[model samples]
Target chain A: MALHYSPVLWNRQKRLYDLTMAGLMALYLIIFCTLQTSLFPPITTETIVIRATSTLAFLMLHVILVIGPLCRLDNRFLPLLYNRRHLGVSMFIVAAVHSVFSVLQFHTRGDVDPLVSLFTSERQYGSFGQFPFQPLGFFALLILFVMAATSHDFWLKNLSPRVWKTLHMSVYLAYALIVMHVALGILQQETSPVYAGLMGVGVLTVSGLHVMAAFIGNRRELHPNAPATDGFVAVCDVNDIADNRAKTLMVNGQNIALFKYDGKLSAVSNLCRHQNGPLGEGKIIDGCITCPWHGYQYLPENGQSPPPFTEKIETYAVRCVGTTVWVNPQPYPPGTPQTPALLKVTTINDEN
Target chain B: MTPPLRRAHRFIWLLLVVALPLGFLATRPTKQSPWLQEPVLPPQSTAMPVLLRTIDADSLVLNLRQSVRGTERQLEILLKQPFETPSAVVCIRQEGSRRAVGLLNAPGLYRFPLPTGTNRPLVEIVDDVHGRTVKTVQL
Candidate 1:
């Protein structure tokens, strides 16, 4: 969205989002610390900070993991996805504080270095019940640190979207590591079943939402059952698509988004140039296809962003024979201008 | 997301759905280890001897004896066999403060002068190499 990279591209929404996030984090900390002190009078301040920050970080991670699926299930959650990088970075900072405090409390005051002591402190690698869990936490924190470091759009541009996305996908691995870190670490010592039950619920909710979202997304994908004639695949009727909206079609291994607007039909690759968002889910705003995930706009005819922007997507040759819209599965190069298929006046009048 | 990424996501979640609960259930404490369980304070009788065993399978045992000598109480660690862990050391924790007493690698008696006003001190055998407490006995 930015032509030049600044430290951050802050807008009114981003400012409000950050302020709300900070306020909620501060409030959670106050409530957690107050309750922890009242319930466990013998607990030390160091332990309280460690527990509070760790729990907060873990909760934030669950929220981050669910936002994508939530947004997929309902577009109303897109706002949460917009500023998610800030939440991720904040979670990493909290996790780092927890890690540092834990090391200082448990690993310091020893003859060996704190890092070395952390690994050597517990020699129960062979025992499942007594395995050393700190190293797992350390590795998970390392992954989060990498993700937080590369969260900027600058990295996204330099690394290319595919590489960047693949790197960020490792968040799932990090989440898995964190789950085991909690399961094998403090859960072993804590006698309360409430902690275990809460953890189990968190795991189930995160996984369940992802599975549901994937199922919905799969159902939305349209695959042509009939073979193509002369490289043109009959996708759907012109009336099947609403004005300014698109219907996604899969033909000849190509994912296409066929858009109907002003009695004209155009087909373009469903994959948005930015973040590979499903362009078919977006609407034509101001005569341009606006990506639902991020408002990255592209001209429907040329599959190119408007002036002052350089992003583009592959366009397909499309035509309407009597009201049945057919699209050539072979795609033109990105930004290739294609003639839109105009609907017949009688057909438009009949539908009206 | 691409089809491959979606497939990977589904596979990962499926694995987690099965693995997470299993891992958590496996972590449940079937029987509490002696070192992890609540410490039972021994009676303040000099005649009664307290015995502690290492957490590992080595079965290394140490007898703790408390005796009064010249108006001062002394705690002695009598090891029946040499410690299997060469870096093990005997430590005393009293009133939230811990101090190493002596090495337990030798199969002999080691004595440490117990400070006056020490109450219900916990005796521990720590493996310095691993930086873990291997045994604990409360007195």
Candidate 2:
């Protein structure tokens, strides 16, 4: 993915994505400020900036968390997953703004340093309702800063995907810390049920989506069929896949999407290169599998996007006998074109 | 973007644009709210019979108190302790007249005699160093 270690690739898609992200962020801030001023008149500039940046960062974090399981549920969501690191970095910047402003507002001009005062402002560690929440947020911000700084492929390559992914997984811990920070900090002070309810909804939506995706994945894996013979496996009957759609199967420890398109059957790796989106959940459009998340398309025969688009996925050989479709689970090199297995006349006749 | 994802993006934007304003409106502080309102002054005490309020002018503490005698409640004013300055003026407002009562730097309490039948007169503690009323209290 990296030709050289030059900052970013700066492709059209990435540029467009970043532009959209920036627009949304601006919109959110504008709305937040307008409402805050309109309702609570004579608001201080520091308070406005602190609330606006913190809320924007919180919303961005929710979006980032949802993208992962969303990609799992449908490959069409992969486009959002493609450049999610940018969102993370943006979130960290906004959060940093909030952090700096908070320290200046509440902790400065004291006997202690700003950072030191943040922790020492209140000594209610044993009390949950009166806990000193700034420390929790401070630690969470530190984790986000680390993740954002090391989000580039340079770190990914050096750390390896497993290590990189594991490190990034600390986002869950950060999220939990932030939740507690809000719970003990503003929620305790504001005592507004609306704020509490919104936070509850956000937590539920994120957790619910992840649980649902995991459940679906586990259910599919529990299926005892699709036993491999030699290097190939009988995935399903041709009719099991609807026209222009795909049936996902797990074979040889690899997830595969068997597509039935234009009276031909083809197999490709289920994971989309962009975000590991479920390719099988996508539908064929214009003879190319169009992912549901961001509309990234790949031709089934070659597991490659049409020329001018360099994205590709691993392809597999497929065959049909009667109504049964057999797929060679061994994946070919990405973009390798293979002849499609046609549905036999008897299979069509039997269906008719 | 496909129809569904496009719809979702629009929905999210709409929610934030609409819901955020509503949230702010809902949680808006009232004029009477403690955080937004000016802090309440401590209640005047009846147990002491004569309320004494301290006015801090730089490092100096000017104690202003009131006393009831016969038919008149006199305004008593003094520096909590002795000061380096020998002479200072304390102003008392009574019967629509402003009178300057001189105070000595000699330490003990100084009482300001007012016209009989006057009740709860306003006493102003002038700054000994600056020659201006630094604090005002009704006694």
Candidate 3:
């Protein structure tokens, strides 16, 4: 379409550009997986692909979480800010392969239906030699299934962001359970402590970083969430919005993610339509606030996603006076056009 | 979190992570009874309360497949009940070591060969499937 000669154009579209590159990463994965199976015979082809892809997907999603915020922490990192949604969708596909392969591997192994073994496998529950940890992994995989299925924008519109976001939050627990599953079941049974140790380190490091960032950054609720005074109210200091990425406000008792972008800010429902990652935690990538768990992006101005992705969020108007910031509590539909008041940096001449 | 402080906490955290599994390993309970460590159940544990009291040095070497048959059950034989197996020579022990040689005889006895008259130590038939002592024949 059109470029804003304003150097700001780079920041605006860099996310899209970053996303385009991220898409290539998936293609690379597809190629890498294809070549690996071709080179190794005797190793079941589907098993290898599912295993590689599932592992890669899990890793990539974690990277998306880490990278999205890091990119926002610094403007120069904007170039690295890319379409994270593709990364998310692609990871899901690989995870789907892993899930499918696992099911097939566990359910069928010849004429003797293996389904009989899953429950009675003895390894399925705690026994003298068996560890009671299979159900945890099973449950995590099921959670991933739901998160992936409802990742599209259509589901966000139908289910409502509040419900969708809450469901998505379960990913954290799923991840935690997966760790336990590996520890008690796979690591305990398999003699390879090194492999188990490495995997544990990988997951723990990524999770640790997120927790670290959350604590290091603003942990204070600057403005105690004001009871809905009037229809809606400003939730946090304009300085707070500019200082930290976002804050939750009870507007009409509904929590929304107040967004800050390009010296201008907008308030929208905090829940991400894709996987329910925190919209507030998402960085201003490509001039859009993205979901932290899965890279779902929405324009702060109008809540509609950048083209090709149809996700949207409820929109609200944010006004700033001197240093104070106020938010109109009323939320419009995601696709509705919003003419939010833009901030005009102070002019030397206007200064009394 | 400064890098050093963060690292310290992490180091401790990692140490803790390391400590847990090691702790688990240290506290892990295992079936360490030598006599009751074989594939076939060693004669019931002498330590475990058992009714049938029999002490004999009946040792033989034989192929297990052709000897004992039917389900192997952990029976607490009463002192008054008849205690017998398909093979009269059910098990053999090394002279000293509690390690026992368990010969499952489905129907045939002495179906295999052994180092006749030589007892190295002890022979305790340990049920490897479940750490249970089935028969303990002492010389």
Per-prediction TM-score:
0.79, 0.65, 0.52
* CAPRI class of candidate 3: incorrect
DockQ per candidate, 2 decimals: 0.31, 0.04, 0.05
What TM-score does each model's chain B reach against the true chain B? 0.49, 0.40, 0.29
Q: Candidate 2, what DockQ?
A: 0.04
Kindly list the per-residue Cα lDDT of model 1 for residues A1-352, writing each as its tens digit: 4577898888888898899999999999999999999999999999999999999999999999999999888978988887888999999999999999999999898789999999988887898766778998999999999999999988988998777878998998899889888988878777788988999999999988888888887787778777776677778878989999999887877888999998899999998877777889889999999888767899999999998888999999987878788789899999999999888733323433
Per-model CA lDDT versus the true structure = 0.81, 0.72, 0.54
Identify the candidate with maximal lDDT.
1
lDDT of 3 by residue, A89-135 (tens): 56666666766676577666645656455444545343432355556
Off by over 4 Å in 2: A1-6, A11-13, A70-83, A154-158, A217-232, A243-245, A261-264, A272-275, A282-317, A328-340, A345-352, B1-139
Alpha-carbon deviation at A207 in model 2, angstroms = 1.7
CA-RMSD of model 3: 11.9
Clashing pairs in 2: A76-A291, A76-A292, A76-A293, A76-A294, A77-A293
DockQ-based ranking: 1, 3, 2
Give the alpha carbon lDDT tens digit for every residue of B22-119 in model 2: 44333333212323432322223232246455555543444444465354344444455655543455566776786665544555555554555555
- Model 3, span B6-62: residue lDDT tens: 234345434444543443343234312223234544443422222222333334231
